[model samples]
Every structure is written in C-alpha cells, then in structure tokens.
Target: MTRLFTVPLAGAFALLLAAAGCGGSSTHDSTGDASVTIRIPDPGNEGLLALGKKDGSLAKALAVVHAKVAWTGSSGPFAPAAQELGADKLDVAQGSITSAIAALAQHPGFKLFAQIAPNKTGEGILVRKGSPIASVRDLAGRKVAVNKGGTAEYLLLKALASAGVPAGRVTRVYLNPAQTAPVFNSGQVDAWAVWSTYSIPEIASTGARFVATGGQIGSQNYSVWAVRNGFADAHPAVVQAFSRYLHDAGVRQAQNPASYVNVFTDAGPQAVSGTARRLTIQDLAQTAAPDGIRPSNVTDFDAVARFFAEQKITPTAVNVRPYVLSLTGSGS
Candidate 1:
C-alpha cells in the first residue's frame, strides 16, 4: 500500500485541473493536461488541500499540461483504484498512516509516496459533566463505549492501559461516536471514547468533561497519504508533483490556522460548524510529521503496531520499509 503526507500552500494549479473534469486519459502535455484523481478521508477536515483545489493551485499547474485533479473519498475505492489504474479511477488515497498500513495488509498494491502534515490533535474521552467519573481510573468496572472496528478503539485501549487501568477492567461496549453520546448521557454507557470534533462539543453541550486525548498517546496515529505502487512507478513525475503540492499545503496550514478552518467550514457539514471543528482541527494538526506518513519507519508506529498486535487487530506487525516509497530511501 502507498502512504504519503501533505500540507497546503498554493492554488491556481488545482483550479485549472478542476475545470478539466474526468473524461480524458492520463496523458501528460507540456501545458499539464493529464488527469489524476485522489481519495481523501474525512473530507470535512481537509481544509487546506480543499482550499488549494478550489483556488486552482494544483489544477493550473497540472491541468492541460500533464495532470488533472479529482478529489474522491471512500474506503471501498482502494481495491478498485489498484485494479483500474488506466481507467483513471484514483491516483492517491488519503487516510491515517495506520489505515494505509491496514489497507496494504489487505491489498499490497499501494505504495508510500511522501509525508503529509501530521494530524496533530482532535481526540478526547468524554463523560457528562457532574458525572461521578472524573478520570480514566474511574472507568474501571464501568462500561466504556467505542467504535469496535476503529482506530479510536485501539487508541482508547492504549490510553486506558497507559492511564493505569487494566484493559480487562474496563468494559468496552462497541458503538459509534454518535450512538455512544446519547447512550452515555442516558447511563446506557458510563463513558465514551471519541474524537474531539464531535465528542468535545457534545460534551460541552451536555456539560461533559474530557478524560484523555489521542495526542497523549503519540503522533503517528493521525492521517497520511497513499498511492498504488504500480501507478507511482509508472508515473513518478506526477507522484512527485502531487507530493510537493501536498507538502506545501501542510506548510500553509501550519503558517495560517484560522484561514485553514474557514476553508473547510465553507464546504464541510454542519457538525463542524462554528468553533467546534476549528478547535478540533487546530488541535489535531499538531501531532508532528511522519516520515513519509507511514509507521514502518517510526518509533510511535512500533508502539502502535504492538498495541494492535496485542489486540489481535492484525495477524502480525507490518514491515513498512519495503512498502513505502521514499525519495531518500531512508525514513525521517
């Protein structure tokens, strides 16, 4: 599987590509007429890149010359993208570095390209305000809600163990963040492990308090980028171009905070409206950059991988070096 990281910087290039649509073949021209579509996760939090796209930064540079930009987000698209490279389905897939690893474990077609910005914040444990549960220790013997088949669940498992609670001591009740909230408030679940964007605001509205955050666990747990290996090898130039632009976008997000949030607010859903999403995004953007956005080369990934292995989330730990595509051949 391919994994990469990015930051927002410019526009105009993206705008020109957006105008070209998806009918043409993936041919390159001096004026940049090639078409490339990328899938992103949580498009709502993807403000900086979306802004670059809307402003035509990537399109103008790639469009009509050798590249076109189509932004798609879907979990099911990974396998299809791998099988249909010539059909022009996808060039890049956006997701957490771990998710990319999992994808590779399932389908070893994608390759790691480059590093995107570290999704530094946006996680927290929630409990209704004035509830007797004030900290992670209190979760003992009480039921805790989590999305069963999610990274958040792993995060919570680790966080709880690190917080001095036995993993088996706390009951893990599977539930989506949305479902867990009401049940938590109603006493169906004692506490809920959730991302900050939804959980923080929901807690504030319901007078809840936070018990922990993902950031407390480490940096490699956030989002990253990936591309199909065959596609990256066939089109090195395009991969490099996209990687540079994404890196620049990460720089822009770091340099300007609120502006990035505004970009997402314009196109994102109501759930992230006003201050909640902005705060959450700002929080998540601080986790620190990954070496090409994959865990195979990082220490944090080791801890995370061990946690997953112990949890039996995967049959074995992943070796990220052979899978990742790095400019230097050595990781950051």
Candidate 2:
C-alpha cells in the first residue's frame, strides 16, 4: 500500500504540526526541518497526485531531498486547502487556476510555482440525455449546479458569456462536488457545470450530453501546484525537487498512460476507464511546462480575476504577480 498519510481538513493544522516535528515546541520555526505537508483533494479519480501516490513515486521523489511528506486529504473544494496554506498549516496544495487566483486575492501569502497539464476536454456543461437544454443559450432561467466559488462557477460564467447569455439569466445552484451528479440526475438542477473527474464519470454512466465544453469557450482549465510564500522561501530546494518530480511524472505518464491508469484502478475505486484515464493523462502531459510560472499564465490569471470582479463573483480585481514565485534558477 502507498505510505501517503490522509488527514481530515478540520484536523489538518494539528497534524501539520506533528508532521513537522513541532509536537512539543512552542517556536513556530520551520527552517530547520526538511519535512513538508501537502494537501491533495481525495483522489476519487486518477489525478496526477493520486497516480504518483499509488505507485510510491511521489514519496520516493520527496525522499531525494530528505524531505518527509505528510499527505492530507481535502474533502471538498480547493478553497479550504487554500485557507490551510494561508494559515501556514500546509506547505503545498493543488488547485485550479481560478481558485488559485481567488485565494491569492484574499491571501497573497500563497504563490503558484507550477501547473499541471491543461485538460479542457474534461470540462463542460452537462445536461440530462433528453433535457430541453440543448445549448448554453437555452440555460436562461434554468437552474445549474456549480460548486460555487470554484472552477465550475468560472467555467459556467465564461461558457454562458460565450453563448451571449447574461450571468443573471440563470439560477446558480451551489453544491459540493459530491452533490452535483446526484442533484443533476434527480432533476433538482437543470444542468451541471463541472470538469473531467466528475463530469466524465457522470457522462459515461448516465448518458449525459454536453452543451458546451471548456475548449468550445476557449477556457483552459489548468490545475496548479501552489506553495505558501514563507514555506517556499525557507525550503526552495524542496520546492525545486518536487517540481522536477512532478514534471518527470508527467512525462512518464505520457509515455505509458496504461501503466498509470492501471495503478489507479488497482489502488482504489475503478470509477474511470483506462481510455478516459489515458486521455486525461495525455492532456495533462501535453500541456505540462517547465518549473516556473509563465507570463501567459499570469496574464490568464489576471483575466480570470477581472472576470470574477465583473461578474461580482469577487469583490475586487487582483494583481497576480505579487503571489508568483520564480524558480528559474532553482535547479527544478
């Protein structure tokens, strides 16, 4: 079995301290240890982090820097994980570009260091098989399930705008990730705005139809890895090592997609098929870039912030540069 540790989001802070060897010490100094805590959403499907954990590759890679990892499971959306990173309870966390931007607006202490491959194919607006909602424009006055304040909400807004639909025309039903499929299937919501892991499975099992995809709206949903500013400053080497590890993993998965897909099915629930897993992994690998955040990424993030502000999703526009860290020469 994989040696990754799983902790509930509520008790993550206390476990973070214990993982860092700060059990009895009052001093909050994290400079002396090479240990780090990373929080990943529960690997319900085969994400990169989940694949790495299942194969022992993630743990082995971290050991290269003599860094111990305390893996924590985030039960809900990326917002809570961002909160944990801001409170200094987590060294690193994974989130979407939209969520990361929103988090940075509130807590500039978090810096995006790297991004996973983009998977636009997995993101779309899903409707029941025979639902009358045939297109994004048809969503007016209908209820749509979105994980409010998350990638889903952003995608939905962008998709609607692309279809010439105003944001206020639809009823935005906020639901947790786990609640989306059931609610949509039960007719509680007219449609669901979701990405691959959730959207893919539901489409496969329930014969749902896609009204619009992220690709159709030119929305590139990139899953990103961000670290607390203080943590990155204190442990630059560890960050570099982890970045390389992730990049390498992306390459490996790209080369042998079947292997990673098998790992996911063998290690946990077989919710996704080998074909879907392979396509998702391929999309991630094809879009994987080097260690540092690119200028285009920053520009896109700023654009997302502006969109959020214009839609009243965010209270204000955020400047993304302040929360970006440069790992150019860090040997990543």
* TM-score winner: 2
- Cα deviation at 134, candidate 1, in Å, is 2.2
The residue-by-residue lDDT of candidate 1 on 1-332, one tens digit each, is 12232212133234324333334544353234345444333344345566676677867555433666655553332334444432445567655555555555566767666654433345656777778886778888988787653555766676777787778898888865555666888988887776654565775466676676666645346455677655565545566556656666666666665566655345545435555655656654663333354344555555656666676766787666676664432222
Off by over 4 Å in 1: 1-46, 73-89, 116-121, 177-180, 218-220, 264-274, 277-281, 284-297, 329-332
Worst 10 residues of 1 by lDDT: 1-10
lDDT top scorer: 2
**Candidate 2 per-residue C-alpha lDDT over 76-137 given as tens digits, one digit per residue, 9 for 90 to 100:** 46788888887877778777888887777677668888765556677889899999987899
Off by over 4 Å in 2: 1-45, 74-76, 262-291, 329-332
Per-candidate TM-scores read 0.72, 0.81
RMSD of each candidate? 7.6, 8.1
